[model samples]
Target: MITATPRPSATPAHLRDASLVDPLRVRRAGPGDAAALVALSEPFVRAGALRRRPFDVYAARAADFLVAEEPGGLLHGCLALRVHPDAEPGAAAAGVLYNFCVARQRQGSGLGARLLGAALTGARAQSLAALFTATTGSGRLFLRHGFAPVPQGLAPRAWARTLDPRRGARVLARAL
Candidate 1:
């Protein structure tokens, strides 16, 4: 069984109180959640909201993810905090937050915020010096969470190499 570390209930003042409508519980993704994670991410992939990652990728990196689940094992959202492969010990670790998705039905709800908060908390716990991400649309949610737009050249080389210029993804980063 995968255990989740409970995060503080404090919500960012800029965001709505999603807990008032439907509270969320965020937890680390376990082996069993692979299929569910892929299922939740499919719609975003189809809509071009996110890149398509194979099942093997999700399975291999399950430990790097955090999921927001509702009562009765229903998963509402998920995100991945991928640490830079070249990060050296004692140096500021770098990571990228990617594959973030919330169910279409629950988009307006607070599940996204809860999931993001959990990811940030996880990054902090890991002592990451910076977190980065790419978005194709307006980045209001990320901006609200302290992320600022940055040039693609400033992103980690590995991440920047994966960018498809045609998609026009805007890179953003936040220093911890």
Candidate 2:
């Protein structure tokens, strides 16, 4: 139920026409948001920017997601943080960030940053030791947020096994 503070109006000149809405909120995703989450991720799936995930996948992992929503309940973006399953009790957890996407029209309006902030906050709340993400494109956004390029082998084994080598994904990590 953490809410983002209102964004400033200091948008870059190129994005002056951006439909940057105020009062945006980031919250934990619930079962009811499954469809919207799928819809939000569809374009990325088609573009191969993200792997396709069925509605049932979202439903089953709903608690692992965070969504950016407008006052009227329209979803603006979504991010998922998957905690690695521990091999033994009391081991510190690691996490994988995936399925991050922003509404096409809102792409340059800072919604991604808001959603990322919320997800990171949630990760810290869960006491994760570090977070990892794989990106097919540039890792600029994640780098700016403190992530550093790392060998794929450094990722949690369960998560690394899920990566597709053909995707040429660059692995990045940030310790909490």
Candidate 3:
């Protein structure tokens, strides 16, 4: 298992105190974290809540992702920021958040909100106007954080898949 360096809690006390979720240490992901990342994401991948992405892809894109590691070096959750590095500057600085999963034992423990905050912080730093994601569950969480459903045709292929022909997806975006 990959170990995560400890850090102060990433979430504020108010949010942490109000929920059943525990605190987490959020950090940038590294190549050594690929396997853990894959494992953390499997449940969603199998349920079609997340796309089938390979471990190597996580390693390759480690620079664009973040992980919430518990004190013991175990990965509780992850969130990735997807965007083309060379895309036009004025195009709203788009990003799609993917592979966000909290360990089964840690679900509902404020870790997801902390991860989302970190990703949104990264997006704003990159001059992104908004951050987007698709959720099969937790629509309320996104809504609580100011995300709203985006119209069809506005999302990319990966994101559009969230809107499957068999079962529709819920798209949400938050302006940074």
Candidate 4:
């Protein structure tokens, strides 16, 4: 059975405070961030906002992650650049953005934009010709970031299943 994602019982007090003051801070997540990352992502997983991988999987891959934390350290949103094994020698490396989320109340603060920009920057640095992701709600944001959809039936690994008949997450790519 799929696990249910947890919603905030109430906005954390610090977020209320941040709403009155600074809204966010972005930084690399470290070893200590595993639990918080899980908390931040659990809701999405439960809601199918992301594919549910075991906690250990996330922890094992944590180094590629980043978070937008409120001043009180509540996890607001996260994004990661997970490298895929090269399919061809000397080919441009490729990576994907996973678990992209913004806290329920913080959805419009440009956090997704910030997160995607960082992912794209990392992709360029790695000489990746393109960056890819599967979106849950809309692909417009990815399009704005220069990602175009992969043609129907030609979707890449993991991405093919991200989309369903109605709410299918289309595969998008941005040339690096």
Candidate 5:
């Protein structure tokens, strides 16, 4: 069986500094984590790194989130995975990752990689054929994890339709 947590060696060298991270810090988020999730993603939202979602939205979709918590009761990072069954009548299942953010102090410390690794595991658990994401930045992290540019027309239909032209985000996908 695939474990939900990432093994130390599963992360790429460039993405995580193993000596600075705790593999166990990343855990599934519960409804109780809603507010923290919102707070954690707030900076990204303000910087246009992510879209804004209110508190109730976070509470309602808490099940879709995975969060990295510090021993001091702070959320250091978070990522959400929304599974979409198919793009066409017979396409394989797939998932879209969103609201990905790591505390500014925590960036480049492997917490983000560990979070991504965990979400990849979750996607596999759901029998997903691919994982997709839209990013406004260089997407270097996604590239290191094997994601490549995907034409919007080739991405999951339902999910692709939601992409905002105003954001000018690039679409990327990694097939499982």
Candidate 6:
């Protein structure tokens, strides 16, 4: 039999009050944010909703991330947009969204939607031809944001090549 340990929630106790909906500003992440990124995504990783990634990887690719932050340096959410050039047969550029996470206290308060919106805006800013993401969950948020079901082959070839078969993630795409 396997036993699981009860880890303390990453959310601070004071922030758990459901009525407290503080303003969270979404911004691009920097190299110094690796530790917080790992902490913010740890629960999702443990829940099997996200693939586990190391601190070094986050640090190395910090520019690909966007984080939701409140005053006093608290991070409530994060998402990564990895731009893939030479993505398709015709040399179309695209972005692959990944590592999306929100603190439990911030979920359902439109923070997730806000993050997705920011990512879409960023993709547009970069003039990406399309945006793609793979999700193991219901993907209702992505669907609501105009991402529809797509074959893995439709995603950026380099990204699709790296997907783990065992994770069974469904690919979704939306044109920019």
- lDDT tens digits by residue: candidate 5, 1-176: 87697566676766455635564387888999998998898999999989899999999989999988878878999999998887378778889999999999988777788899999999998889999999999999999999999898877789888889999999999999
TM per candidate comes to 0.84, 0.85, 0.77, 0.76, 0.85, 0.85
| Candidate 3 per-residue C-alpha lDDT over 67-97 given as tens digits, one digit per residue, 9 for 90 to 100 | 9886788998888988633245556656788
Residue 4 of candidate 1: its Cα lDDT? 100
- Candidate 2 regions exceeding 4 Å error are 1-21
lDDT of 6 at 117: 91
Q: Give lDDT: candidate 4, residue 170.
A: 68
lDDT of each: 0.87, 0.89, 0.77, 0.75, 0.88, 0.92
Better of 1 and 2 by TM-score: 2
In model 6, where do residues sit more than 4 Å from their true spots?
A: 1-22, 87-90
Model 1 ranges with Cα > 4 A deviation: 1-23, 85-90
User: Of models 2 and 3, which has the larger lDDT?
Assistant: 2
Worst 10 residues of 3 by lDDT: 84-93
Residue lDDT tens for model 4, 1-176 = 89999885986677665335556787888878888888888888889767776778778878889788878988888898877655578776667777787888778777788777777777778777667777766777788888888764433455445556565666777767
Model 2's TM-score against the true structure: 0.85
Cα lDDT for residue 132, model 2? 96
Tens digits of per-residue lDDT for model 6 on 5-39?
A: 99987987888653365567889999999999999
In terms of lDDT, the poorest run of 10 residues in model 2 is: 14-23
Better model by TM-score, 1 or 6? 6
- Predicted structure 2: lDDT: 0.89
Give the clash total for candidate 4.
Answer: 3
